[model samples]
Target chain A: MQSGEDLNQDFRPETEAGGLTIRLDVFQGPLDLLLHLIKREEVDIWNIPIARITEQYLEYLEIMKELNINVAAEWLVMASTLIFIKSRMLLPREPAPENAEETEDDPRTELVYQLLEHQKFKNAAEMLFTREEVENAVWNRPPDEVLEDGGDVIAVTLFDLLRAFQEVVRRFESQRVMEVAQEEVTIEQKIEDIRKCFLVHDQLQFSSFFTAASSKRYIIVTFLALLELVRLREIWLFQQQVFEEIQVSRIKESA
Target chain B: MQAVMEAIIYVAEEPVKAEQFQEVFPEESPEAIRRALAELLESFNARPGGMWIREVAGGYRMTTRPEHHEQIRAYLKTRPGAKLSMAALETLAVIAYKQPVTLAEILAIRGKKSSSSLQTLLERKLVCILGRKEVVGRPILYGTSREFLIHFGLNSLADLPTLEEFAQMAGDQL
Candidate 1:
């Protein structure tokens, strides 16, 4: 409470005297800084006095610069905007519109509007932070509680399967480039190849499809063909466990 | 009936709405079902176990207590817990409030590029694509998902507290 002029004084970047270091982490963006200013000054958002707020905004930037905090460009753009509005406010006012009151219309109206709009979202953000903080403690129960139903099937999404494919792809992939004209392996042909491989064994490893593939094109084509089979539910792709070799199994349609 | 209710809520995958239980017991009233729920809540609250049933996203389900998070985290080392980055959480907050919003709209509010964060949220099933926004590019509309509600322990969209509430609290402390 020492030398505290406002309630938001704690949130404002506290400069360390005789030492220089400020946490820029607190500033979310340009609007966040403006919100801090408005709160600290207790200014009426609808009728902001541009000169004072702009001065304070620029001073914070100065301190940030002196303390060697890397400020983002958006913050500087806002600074320019505030300065422009303050300069306009200092100039003589134009005559009011026919239906408008002189005091009601000001050059600061647009800037104030933007600030108010940003403030609403900022408040929502704060609420979300609290929810995250509280929910971080509450863990979802085990599979006994079935909110989302249907066969578990490993709960693998297309992206997750793709990532798993990448891991296996890295192992057997050769670095040979294939010209389009030299190797025009269609996805259908690759699928046929995979089917032929599965005929020899009930299951095949992820990298087995790329076996003897001299070019990246063949490997990519084989991967795409696998994805097509997966999409059709003709085959299922999964690892025995996490980080294990991915195995492809044929769906039991008779069951 | 309450014991049956407790088992059903604990075993159910999603939140067990009272209407669902009402359908099972055609003659029972919703008020009676609600009373059963209140009794269950009281009984659970009285216990000191690491698990408790909570009404989240419109139904009741058991969730692990926060105090046991560290212990459970250690126990469940094989699996990854649902954790979000600051940027993603901020973006989610905006979408949770102003849903059916576009990437451009989110970027405008966050004052930063949010494509990566949006992708992460989509992958986590926390945010979902609600369809095109009917704007210039027909950009995909984004909204918070049922998974989002469950993850955040929200009973419904109405459960979200206004942001100014926290700011007001800060003011009071000052």
Candidate 2:
């Protein structure tokens, strides 16, 4: 429960007794993970808070290491790149050229450009995902899908996948911040709150618990806690209609 | 002749080419069938209806009006066909606009390795190998499948909006 920087500092390098196990959740890869982190931080992608972002990035790596998640080389290289940029940023700026019009280039500029360029494609990806979601609802003929797989496959669009992934990432971010701040309300506390609500009502609206959030961090953590409960199969997310409010329902076994 | 052509187009599960209409009814000339198709399209446009015939992938098919999307969606819950992930979609988009492109071409645009995404798209039958790129590595060239046209509800590759159009749409949204 250390700060991101502290987590990196405290963790031993050789404690990787656990074998690498990365669940290939198709929606979340290296860039997607970085984008999620950047979005949760709510900073300009063009002007990243490199030092803090790098700390958080490495902290994620630390957790992944502990869990033995297979860290891709791209992620490691990006980490190195961030560190390289940080180092370059630390160095004193070079004096301007004789032309007097040119300015010394910031080391972060290249990475920032890459992120922005990546963002454009990501935006385009989102557009196509949305289009698929839209056009998918109406079909001239039924698509040739092997639907008899029996409840294993979730036909979630990238949009839903990304949204769900985003929520989890945001929740993870909040949880880290809470750990740093030493908050009174833990995810376990939120789980308890959810259980109490389920006792009172058959179903709970996701938004009803918080009409207006005083702290974005706590709300996100609560949502994350809710997801953890869902992961444990204690509850499930459902909606009566597309674009309707999501509701929480307790599993029959849990009752 | 127009009625016969409508019947033929209606019966087709996939898009029906004008040549297909001629081939099916060899007694009718391709020119006559083309005229019938034009007239049928004009009639559909003139009338207010849920269905409209549109050309896609070098063939014509009837599709529901976008305005009735919500109503149709309500009536047919869980019919929202197959989905492509953002990674796959981005890979597909790159291939879509810059078709007959190699895997490298797609990777260059997206700035990520698209091996898995491309495989997923191929499995979904949304994209297919057009041919070999004829370059040194000769990486397989990819293009949108006919199924992709049906899936995206596009009349043709030409139906895809230009990047500027997308920018304008984004501008409007903002």
Candidate 3:
């Protein structure tokens, strides 16, 4: 792994003599730059010439220093990983293991696979954005695109899923400690307790409902019961702001 | 009844919650609804499906299982004109990073007027008016919405990419 100062000193000639402006912002990180170089060179991932890749990788690092980019540790980590892999490839190889005959997989395959996978998702996300642009252009519809005749269908966005997951996690964390000592409570009894709580109150502070529970098992059961209620839409948890205490309101079937 | 719930989720393009079931069984109690939902959840978990129901945004919605995200991406690729434009992305990035910001501030950062782009973002529900900033003019403060979080697969505003990272990315332009 090359330090920023080391890479800068090495590449001083290129910046001082070459009369070319360098910018580190173009590359998000070393991995990003490496991926770009790999694509540009059209090199075989399985048979990557470590020497060539290392040269290009180091050159970029130097350019980053020339541009005065504050390179993070992630880039340095990748640089070390690359250097290690390169050295490993150059080392004298022992005789192939008995199982070596079974598979001829390259050691670099996993790295390439990870790079490819990351790029694939990144591209997919970009594509989704492009689609939104085209859709907006072609159709002059209402602000909300209401798909008619899907009565039971509810459009739950990604944010909604995250919010729900956060709520569940928060509930789990806050209630995990305080134990409500009493007789052993069954899941059925917990469900009954929750129903009774909802019946008396129009809404319960989500945290308050669990404060009475003492045992981990009871908490788990209560959590499961809460999930069941949520799944059934028997209760709706509403938080006006992020990280705020969520309020759970019983949903009337008629309403 | 559990089968019915599974069938409903399977055929529906979006998520379906247990309350949606109550429309079919109008007289059922909340307890009964809870039981039915428990059964449905158990049934779905037992069998394999590309999608599963989860409680989100105060309601139940079906989403593709995380394991199937790649397949979903492949299917999504088959559909045309779904990618976002660079300008839209930049605008989104601005809102995401400097959220609860006003249109004026966004324009200032962007170094140009962004009324049209702001309108587009608002229409898309990616950004929403958080409230009015108490300044001389009381301009509406804009922030990324929950839809924005979901689109980016972030749990909360805190999940947004670090300011340092953005600064590093911006350094390229320098």
Q: Estimate each model's TM-score.
A: 0.66, 0.59, 0.34
Whole-model Cα lDDT per candidate?
Answer: 0.73, 0.67, 0.60
The DockQ for candidate 3, computed on C-alphas, is 0.04
lDDT of 2 by residue, B39-100 (tens): 99999767898777777678887767777877888875655555776668778877887788
lDDT tens per residue, model 1, B38-138: 89989986899878888888988887888787777687563443567666777887898789899999988777667888988996789988999776889
Model 3 misplaced stretches (Cα beyond 4 Å): A1-26, A98-106, A135-255, B1-174
Candidate number achieving the greatest TM-score relative to the actual structure: 1
The segments of candidate 2 whose C-alpha lies over 4 angstroms from its true place after superposition are: A1-27, A98-104, A141-255, B22-35, B45-50, B64-79, B108-111, B164-174
lDDT of 3 by residue, A1-255 (tens): 122333334333224454654344334345556666666676765567777888888877766665665566667777787888788778876778776752254556666655654343334334446434433322111112133421122333335545655565566677576545578877778778889987899877766765655655665777678778787878866654455556677877652
Report candidate 1's fraction of native contacts: 0.42
Ranking by DockQ: 1, 2, 3
lDDT of 1 by residue, A1-255 (tens): 122354344335546786655555555677666767776777777667788888888887887777677777887888998888888788887876798876575777776656666656655665666677677766665563132432233435566667766765675454544544565789999888777767777667776676666656667887899988888877877654555556787765631
Which number leads on lDDT? 1
Specify the poorest-scoring 10-residue window by lDDT in model 2 chain B.
B165-174
Worst 10 residues of 3 chain A by lDDT: A136-145
Question: Which docking class does model 1 fall in?
Answer: acceptable
On DockQ, who's better, 1 or 3?
1
